[model samples]
Target: MIKETFSKNTRINKKVCLTTDFVIAGGGLAGVCAAITAARAGTKVILVQDRPVLGGNASSEVRIWALGATSHMGNNNRWSREGGVIDEIMLENLKTNKDGNPLYFDAILLDKVSAEQNITLLLNTAAYQVNKSLDTKIDSIDAFCSQNSTHYTISAPLFCDATGDGLVGFNAGASFRIGAESREEFGELLASEDESNQILGHTLFFYSKKVDHAVTYKAPSFAYSHEEIGANPRSKNIHGHDSGVKFWWVEYGGIRDTIYETEEIKWELWKIVYGIWDYIKNSGQFEDVDNLTLEWVGTVPGKRESRRFNGEYMLKQQDVVEQTNFYDAISFGGWAIDIHPSEGIYSEKPACSQFHSKGVYQIPYRCFVSKDIDNLYFAGRNISATHMAYGSTRVMITCAHGGQAVGEAAAMCKDLSVSPKDLLEKELIHQLQQRLNRFGHGIPGVALDKSANKVSFANIFASSELVLKNYESCGDYVSLAQSAAQLIPLKKGNAPIVSINIIAERDTEIVCQLRTSEKPENYTPDIINKTISLPVHAGKQTIEFDFTDVDVIDQYGFVCFLANQYIQLEISTQLVSGTMSVFNKVHKAVSNSGRQEAPANSGIEEFEFWTPERRPKGQNLAVSFDPPLPAFSKDNVVNGHLRPWLNSNAWVSDYADTQPTLKITWQEKVELSEITLFFDTDYDHALETVLMQHPESEMPYCVKSYRIRTAEGKLLADVNNNYQTVNTLTLDSSITSQELIIELDHPSSDVPAALFEIQVR
Candidate 1:
């Protein structure tokens, strides 16, 4: 509710006092995402951001890529896109700003906030003062927006401090920690040996663009001379930059109080930004830069660390290394522990340290709520994490996930009239998980409760047999004499295999077979089902083997092939999971040099071969299946699985244009008010903006248009051109029907039509 208030000078001026369900501070991804989440759940929210635009560091002002599991494609995290608002923003960025303009992202963030009617956005409004009663509950927060010259006080039942520096929590006297912890504090290996006031400093980045004509540069008075730009290794790699955010190493002010000394830090960063560019343009150390000119430089420092709010669960470095699964897990983080030097660019030994996880790890809800402050919750870089663990969770997308969980928790609090800590109960936690799952947020170990699904057992789907696939790839692998043959693992399922094709590129004939693994733990082929010799004298050969009657053994099978003198494997990088590509390599004793096999001059036969390298998992192949069992199965949908099924989890269509239909027939007429569907939109298929730009389009094999029908062919509704993170249909009145049919439309992209999740409530 908005109200007009009067101060001592009541004649003219107006003071605004806004009452809301949740008052969120900071307009970064965490705060914005939290506001959106709560607003979507029908909660009144007031989101105050000090910056003129939203997205904080992600805005045009800071231009940091929204990094998360997709750390700009830096590591081996497969199928790592967190499926929620963040995924939507990522895909939207690809669709609109393919060039990755920082200016364009500002508009995206603005659109997201304005789309929700329940959200009141106060941009350029900084929340600085908080009022707490003797009971220690927050009463109101005082904020000032210079743009409108308005003195406002926002009061709410709940509040979140996503300020990156935990401004609201700090003002409220919440328990928090800053800088690195002593080694004795948490047994953290990365902790400083002795307590110290040091942290990862703020960095300033500059962008350069090339123009048609030659551009000249004269160094600014404050810019460092070439001699002053000394031997920092970052300068060595600074010439002829392409990306706008190349100089992340240009930083200062970690040794000082980062929050209090930001002005000094920004000045230092600006000097370095100018000095680096001056050295590039006028120092004569750069070449091919005649057309390059300075574009944009950050005026304010991009902060890396500040006040760390203490939450119920303090996530230490061991929690990261152990990959602990929390019972109340709300979000997951997979980025490496990237610890930067306190001195930043001036450090002689590399600028940053990194340690990667075996896979993604879970973060608990207890980590987002304050330990001392009763109603205090925070997200972004200030959440409950030790200094060492904060290095990984501080990234924007992971922080966005934390914001998402907070938003949902706030809504739950409103409904139950409980605090953030109260939701930790097993039942309430499960309720939160279910609500999040309904929105398709992937919780690490939580599966959607299947009892709520509309389909029980009667609905039957018959089309081309759907087969579950463990991998996806568009490339081919050919046999190599020196490297050994490719061994593709095929896991046994309920459905029998029809036929499989192998792409071979060799002029010489080779022997291949459907072999079983020596053991589940080992990759070596043990037993053979059928051995066949194929003539491979061509540019490319398609070898097919029918497995309609093959007997399986040990729950696994490998497609093993003999090699030729020279061969090349065609592999697809467009996929996430598929059959593993195996090869054997031999390395020298004292050196890093290695070979596929022993030299030909050796007396002993060069027969020693190892498994293939684990770089590329997706191998291109055509796998088919026959009629499936349990005519109508829960596996048809409602598995809480996000990825597409290769041979299972869906009903396959044998004939194109046949228009496959999946019908759910209940035991009796049931009331259906809502229906949700998840289709196979390839998350691994990223939109390229910088290197290669493709027109924003739907993923292949995605259902473009579809109709809802009953067993009697009664038309209910029709959906067209559906391209979203998920599809949900809600009706004004409940419909009683014994069956529900979803007629498939031909996919716009080349592939099969797929549905991952179908839920009706």
Candidate 2:
């Protein structure tokens, strides 16, 4: 290498210019997903990030666990995991890093983006300037990498602002708001009477290790003393077991300007973190922590609230609580309106206030497009939403879901020669939704477009379909300390009589209720159909709940058993594809109570939360129907719907069928080029990105091995050790066949084989 001597007055770094179809700023989950989606859709993409790694807040640097609609599986939104690219990332992470190592997650993201040949990733680069082709269109972006000492000029027709701070939009002169809107302005019941500048604060996390011997810790001069930390009521929540995201309340700087004073905010957070550690180590309030040593602390704070760019539509409080549907809906969110106090750790108020909707709500396409900037798109926490809605949409995986929508929209826009706004005025919005649903992005009320698929018009039949009959008791008994319910799919007419085995510690009267959701699509048990009381003795007995008089339409029936601490319910180890068990219990982490209480005029409905238990524990109650429910059918595999919503939308094989197979026939020979299979990956699981360990690496119901062949038994493709939900196979050459058959290996002896929609083209 040769050293250059600069004699001029000024010297600049090396400059590089690149042109692409789409440019994305920020390398957070949102940007990574957008870049990957666009790249897969045949668009040349240039993705830029200021950090050394891909994940932004979820990186090893920040270490915040990524959660979305499932909300750590602590609410009533059943089977509501953000799908598409984010779902893939989650499943991949589970396979290799179920322990939730942040560094491994970083590598997974890098691998996903790098695998896409159409994407050019720029690391340690920050977009600092925007060149506008018109008043509302961005021509190019100027970014610089401090590590390489080089400047890059990236030009593109479409630009997406995935930067958590809305950096690109800000540089392009986009309109944005920083604080809560007035209640009167948007008619939001959750908003304050008047507008306020107060916002949620930034938080930092620190990890600890329990060594074999005693470890001593000394506080720096900047660290606050125990007496100083004791001034806040939240300090009492600290314990010896507290670590990682469990200490999410170590926050500050919400009352000040979060953008301009970021450094100051970080410093204050540092002082609080060190002070909290000191208090834990030396205050003598915590026991058995003498062997605990601080392993690492975050260098940067994870920001919660920032500049929210204005879009064509601003999602308000009612849009979430009321579960409003939009004609231009593109994505969905189900997390509660989780707002933290402005005072943060120093506040006398509780750590957070969360209000959940009865079901998942849809987010419109207008929320992802800028109002004034024609070619600008918004993703991540900076999307168009009021303070109340932002509280739910700010989560990382939800942001990534929206990013996939934006990426597909950009690809479509490039093909159609139109702007993002054009999708709203035209019928193209339906096309966009269809594209998203086809790619495993689950929209609540939307179904896949089967007009072009050959399987939609063909005759589909399976070897055998599962008929609901019985889930025998596995001898695993759980105490009825809390109310529990079994969510079962039933046909229209008289509800089936369910028999549940229970052991009573003392004589008690058990109250059982049959219920269903007011909205047929939702899982919330708001409408009570029948109430029955069963008097039991001190011994084990099988109680029958006969709901013959309760008339019900096609929907989910909740067989609820109210809390009776003296009784223990028998549970079955067998996991049905379309069935689950939920409990009316409290999850303090997400601020969920057994029953939600709202003010008279708050407009938020009050309902009991019956959420599922995480796997290895959430066993369905052992129950048998007098007459088996006709829920699963062979035709469901070709039905358009991929995931469970109003119906199971999946064809499950009978338990006795060892070698399950599905056959599709056509009247005449048809040429097939591509075939896609959708398997059940248990969308109900939350799959948190970090700090939470999953019970299993692969979903129990997923098909591990499968084969595809023609009527003559000519093997076309054979796959073994498969774990993903969507598997697409392309023939080496077009093959003409009148009949196609798919054979699958059951994931486990107990868990039956299940398949969702299948597509043939």
Candidate 3:
């Protein structure tokens, strides 16, 4: 028997009360990651998802593929493990299914949360109201689900608002701001001279499939007319043609209100999309319309801007540009400034010209916890950030990293039974860094070494002479040698190493001498010289000079010279180069150290050792290198491709030309041992071929291959046949300096061949 209470004319349905150690609001990437992280850390977690599934923007509703920081396709890199729960879900999907579909995403998310013993998930739940104590702490939240006509009262020690909208914070009376701030506030260059409430617009993404034949579309009423839409003012008119076409450019509703206008803008965008398609088809743009169809229409709109909560520290544009490394950094972001215009329905090009920075910058922990609220943490776009700052950190992967940070912070709170503010101390930050490092999260930056008093140059070349130079004027000597060499700066705590890159045909001999201007009379053996011969063929040559033995004096400097040459150098003072060629040529002089950092300058001539020769009209020359390889046998291939119910498709191939060859340089003598062959999964209808070879060995050998496959006859793995479904093979370390060749068998016609990752370790 359930009782309903009527307050005046309103009726409220009562439900069971659930308690947990941590309660996370919003089921988006940030919330889900936070919940999973907290649960994994041995805390009882309650995850309240507003939707039926877990992933927010990346879910089936939005249908955006999960992308990490790495550029490798299909998981070839090891650095893509930022989201632990996301990776687990992907692994499960790859194991059980072969088709890359949206439905599988939902299933995986549900399975992951439901299977976890420490997490309790409540789907189809929306947080409508919050109850706080007199002390300004969140006590409980009241959630409503219309489908069941029920009200849920959730109580937890720590509350996390993973909602991109910062709904929980707004409702809890937490102070926040909207729109762009003036540049004077944060000393940011990208900030608008005048403050404006206008921000970036939201997007309703859709996917269209291309048919075998072309289709035509008819123009709609809202379609930009020739008179209405013309050349944009920001961009140059190329060949007297207007480049403004309504694609992702059509943006609006950021001025009046970011959240309230999102739905209206979404509806308008949908009309534009379908209406444009209709115009294209009917307007005789193409022929054959039978196969053209819409593949997916995003129900969840991608939001670009929203409320930003005030925190202990506000990340500004200056911090990003200056590459400020904070001691309390918890995450890193590398996306460039992607600002949008305020007036047009679609966004205009960014006003400021600069895009990327010197490198990736760090996000501090103080940005995660709120300044006014206690026991409340925020992640994702809702964190403390200026409008310009959010323009870069609002990407999905960056949000995931923020979510991971908050998740770990929540676990620490539960363990210490203290508020997030109390944990902002220095020692705890170091502990957080250590834990994150263990899980492959790179810290902002740390000094490795600092002393310059004991610097000595070793491994000097025999053909060069050493000369004494004024120690305090190292920069002057570096500028003089700009045409052929450059000196890299060392951080306050960094052990300095000098690297020379050969660029020209000259067999250049370089002499380096270290001296102190303060004590000219005291001559110390702190000098070294190196003369390296340029290779006959143009190629890069690297020479490293270790400075571990020199007795460096205060105000010491070093001088470098091109032996028997007198060439002037041109120097430039720019931190980074605009293009790849210039960037590779410009070396990072100073490491990230808290000291009198060197000025950004480039005076030395950048050297290169490799130069290509012009070939005759029709002549082609082929060059190859052969190195010692390893051997393989049956014992190494313990698991065959025909056993234990292989999950997906399997096959083999022996493409001698395509097979990966091994080039080994043995450092010491060793014995031979059995080799092991790893195989890829049969999931996603992927088939692979494996191969092995001894490379013309006369030793009497008995080779045997085994098959470990599923009961359904799908190939699992094979070692002796030199065929493996997996991407990596580990040869026994005992097999030293032996050349082994391996190949894969051709996959079946029905299955597509694919490989993800390979590693010898």
Candidate 4:
């Protein structure tokens, strides 16, 4: 047994040997993600949670959807690149639940940390005191648990305060600012003209759920009336469910006052919320939702503003709008300038429009480390930024990114035995970029110049690996079919030029052209390209002309090509018939077909087939299943134990039935790699098993052994095959030889048996 002593003033407890290299306070999205990231990088991490669970504001406690860089509620296009620990959590969530709702978010968070070998989670622990070295470096933190009234002293090389409230930073003697800044401070349009300590308000969200039966609820005694809220009619009566009412406009006081004191404000907001619901129910506005019942009422207020730590760098409003690319940027924010009134329940315009940035902007790593205290990093809304800037970066998604960056940086600091400020070196930044890239996090784009002999291209998007093709060229335009067009022009004086402007929505790619129209019969040595990869929003991009030596000019025309999605293209110049020729490499057909190859030797069976038993009528069901079969476990699998099993190539039988009728219900879902079918081929082959096999192209393929048996004492055909001779199966429905069968020789139950093997390809 371990004996511990406690100190009164500092709340220091008997030496509690810290097991983590970094202790991250506040289990909000930022803190949780940071812990996960650091732990994944082979760093021991301790994540302290004030609440019982993780995801502070966006958790079920506050009940808000986790938004991404895009404005859409569930939009994850931009976050695809923000993999690593965050991605692993999301992937796990997708595996268990497809809805992406709050019900499973906690599990996702827990699983992510719990699975990390180096992460220690201490929930219901709040950091209340700090011990620092003479030079103001964070030596240790004293966390207290209210339930047990026990204190824990945790010492770490690096510390991160992901607490949006900046609780740890405040206790550690770190300098921090709160409330709105003067216009002169950050030059933000929404900044208070006069220096004032006003800040954005907090909210307590309540949600309704639809049950099988009708139910109604009345307002609590603590609830207040609309008149008590004192907001304007427009402000108080905004649409709730439809417009997704966020009553942030109702706010009060700042860091100087305890937000707990504003219980009356929350009470008033609740009353207003219920009053609107009652009016809708009684006024007969919509009867369909009469069954709508209150599902949850957030206890932890969704705070939009809080203490801002003073760090090496303070992100200003000008930095955000100017799209300033910081040398030490650790994260990016795309949220708009969203601020709520501080005095009244509502204001004329709670959110300002003038200071809003047009696109995603960078936030530096220095903003995460405290200026006064060494070995301390801050994340989330507590980062070193003026109140106006925090208003925009306070969104949960942006905070998640911040958390990921800090987590990585903190881990790096421990490994190097240095502070976060010192680890912000060029080489360290490169390592961070590499780690983030592996997990799909976005880094600043590296601009590439056009080469004389090669048309090399690079990804110019914020943090994506997508590269550009056919960026510079001049040529005569020719139409491919009717929708696609190309231009082939010879090198001119200094630079041969062909410019094309295309407009497209996010994720849409179109075909482009650069060909010699002079050779209408044979457009040899022509270069046909495709449009640059568009982002999540609609935008336009220009391709300039750079021709060094080639000389060929012909009719230049443009045509839109058939693509996965529809997009409009407009050309400033019309196509004209002409003839000019120079030396150039012929453009070959670019086949995205490379991404759609058939699973090597693998077959898919019963892929997403649904029946009345699997899914009944009038009931919505989400289901996912993976076939059970042993494959060459050694080399076939990538990361997990069931590697070779994933190599099985399974295809759904088209003739079998695509959709399930009354007797058979099936929904054609996404394509699968492979599937397996179990059946009794004959008395001798009682347990006939079909192994849908696919080659593991990314890794070398291998096979262990094959087993076949029956319930009784009978041995089925047990044949061990090598990975070298694995047969390939095509997905084409016309070919019925897709299924490979394992036949048992005898009629004994043991003879006709299930087959298993480890297959590597």
What TM-score, computed on C-alpha atoms, does each candidate reach?
A: 0.82, 0.99, 0.58, 0.58
Best candidate, TM-score-wise? 2
Off by over 4 Å in 2: 1-3
Q: Whose TM-score is higher: candidate 2's or candidate 4's? A: 2
Best by lDDT: 2
Ranking by TM-score: 2, 1, 3, 4
lDDT of 1 by residue, 270-379 (tens): 77778888888777777888889998887767899999988889998877755677889888786667778788877775666655543467889999998877887888
TM-score of 3: 0.58
Better structure of 1 and 3 per TM-score: 1
Residue-level lDDT of model 3, residues 462-571, one tens digit each, is 11111101011112112223322222111122223344333323454434332222222111112333223322223334444444344432221232333333322222
Please list the C-alpha lDDT of all candidates, in the order they appear: 0.69, 0.90, 0.49, 0.49
Weakest lDDT window of 10 consecutive positions for candidate 2 = 638-647
lDDT of 1 at 697: 50
Model 4 off-target regions past 4 Å? 1-19, 73-81, 211-216, 226-265, 282-289, 350-356, 446-761
